[model samples]
Target: MKFKTAFAAAAALTLATAANAQVGPEVGATVYGPEGNTVGTIEAMQDGVVVVNTGTYTAPVPANAFGEGPEGPIVSVTKDQLNAMMAEQEKQMIAARDAALIENATVLTADGVEIGTVTSIDGDNAIVTLEDGPVSLMRDQFATNETGALIVLATKDQLMAALNGGSVEGGEAMEADAE
Candidate 1:
C-alpha cells in the first residue's frame, strides 16, 4: 500500500513538473493563430510580455494570450484579430519613431558616451556626422534611451573610424562613398 502511494505521488510530481516546465512561450518558437495558421514567431519575453515578430512588424502581446496547442503555443485570437492588434501597435511605433526628431539628435553609446549627431534618416539608414566624417548606420542600430536621447550601439572610436573610410570592428565602410 505504501509502495503504491509513493509511486503515485512520484508520477503526479513528474506530471506537474512537465506541465509547469515553461512559464511562457519559448523564444524563436512559432505561434499559431486561432485558424491554425502561423501568424508570427516569438522573438523574446519582456516583463512578462511576449514579443512576437509577424512578417510585417514586431509587437508585444500579453503572455496570457497564448495557450498550448498540438504544434506549439497558439494565440487565442484569430489571424485577423492578431493582425489588427499588431497593426495598431505598429502605427503607434511608427508615430513614435517619426516624432523622435532624429535629425540633429545626439547619438550616444551604450555607456552614454556621445559619439555623433544624426544628420539625416534615409529609409532604413541614419546618416550621422561623426568627428571624422559622415557615416551611415542601419536604423536598427539607433534607439531612444530611457530619457529619449538617440543612442547607438557603436562607440565613438568605431563611428569615427567608419566615418573616415576605415572599417570599424563591427561596422563596414562605404567603399563606393570612400572613392
Candidate 2:
C-alpha cells in the first residue's frame, strides 16, 4: 500500500508539472505592429491563435505570425494591414456562411437528431429557435452536413439545455419562456 501510494503521488506531480509547462502567450502582454508601434494587448489564445484586442477591433493572429521582440510578441503586419486581413477573412467567412444558407437551415446533432432551425445570424453566432426557446450557437460549433443542412457539434441534451435556459458550453440562452 505504501509503494502504491507513492507511485500515485509521483504520477500526479509529473502530470501537473507537464501541464504547467505548456504555457502560451500571457494575457495583457503588449503586442506591437509591423511598424514597431504599439497596437493592442493580448486578450486570449483560442485554438493556438493569439487574439489581440486593439482599441477599435479585435484580431486573431496565428501563433506562427508572432515573433518575440525585445519587448514582447510582435506581428509582421501594421495595424492597417491587420485590419485589412481581418476584414478579408470576415468577408470570406460571411460569404461561406451565406453560401451554406445558415439562416433558416435545419440544425441537427452529430447523431442525426434534429433540434431546431437557425432563425438568424448575428456576428459570429447563429440564433436558433428550438421548440422551447431561442438559443445562440457560435458559428464555429456548426458544420455543413452532406445534405447542406447545418449540423451542431453537440448532443441533443446539450442543445436542449441551451434552449431551456441551462448553460451550455460555448452556447448561450437567448430567451427562455417563463412558465
Candidate 3:
C-alpha cells in the first residue's frame, strides 16, 4: 500500500511537471524530433494544424502529432526522414500536374463532363478549346481525375460563367481551395 501511494504521488508530480513544460506551437518556432534534433520551423498554425517548413517543403502536420520533448515540441519523424518524404511528395505532385497539362489531351469538367480539348500550350497557359471558343487556363488550374483523365479544376457551368462574365446555373460558392 505504501509503494502504491508513493508511485501515485510521483506519477502526479511528473504529469504536473510535464504539463508545465509544453512548448507552444507558434509561427517561426523551431520544432524538434523525439531525440531533440531539429525537425523544422513552424511556418503557420491554423485549425489545429501546423505548417512546418523543413527547408525543402512546407508540410502540414496535425497539432496532436507533437509531444512535449526535452527541449521543445517534438514530432515523431526525424528531420532527414521528414525531408525525404516531403521531397517524394513534391516530386509526385509535379508529375501529376505535368500529366494533366499535356497538349491535345481531353479536358473534362470537375464533374466528369467533357468541356474542351487542349489546343495549344502558350507559355504557362494551356489553351483549351471549349464549346464556343478556345480558353487559356493556368497550368495549376489543370488536374488529373482518379482514373488519370485530364481535367480542368472547374465545373462546366463555372467555366462558362467565367468566360461569359455571368452567374452560372449550377455554380456553388467556390472557395479558393488550392489542390
Best by TM-score: 3
**What TM-score, computed on C-alpha atoms, does each candidate reach?**
0.56, 0.55, 0.60
Winner on TM-score (1 vs 2): 1
TM-score between model 2 and native: 0.55
The whole-model lDDT of each prediction reads: 0.74, 0.73, 0.79
Candidate 1: residue pairs that collide = none
For model 3, what is the C-alpha lDDT against the true structure?
0.79
Question: Tens digits of per-residue lDDT for model 1 on 27-114?
Answer: 9999998878897899998787998888776778888888888788898776567779878866765565556647898878766898
Model 3 scores worst on lDDT over the 10 consecutive residues at 170-179
Q: Compared with the true structure, what per-residue lDDT tens digits does model 2 show for residues 89-174? A: 76776556556646778778866898888888877767877777677767776765666666776668765675556865665442
> Which regions in candidate 2 have their CA more than 4 angstroms from the true location?
1-24, 102-105, 109-155, 167-171, 176-179
CA error at residue 75 for candidate 2, angstroms: 0.8
Tell me the lDDT of model 2 at 145: 61
Error of 2 at 129 (Å): 8.7
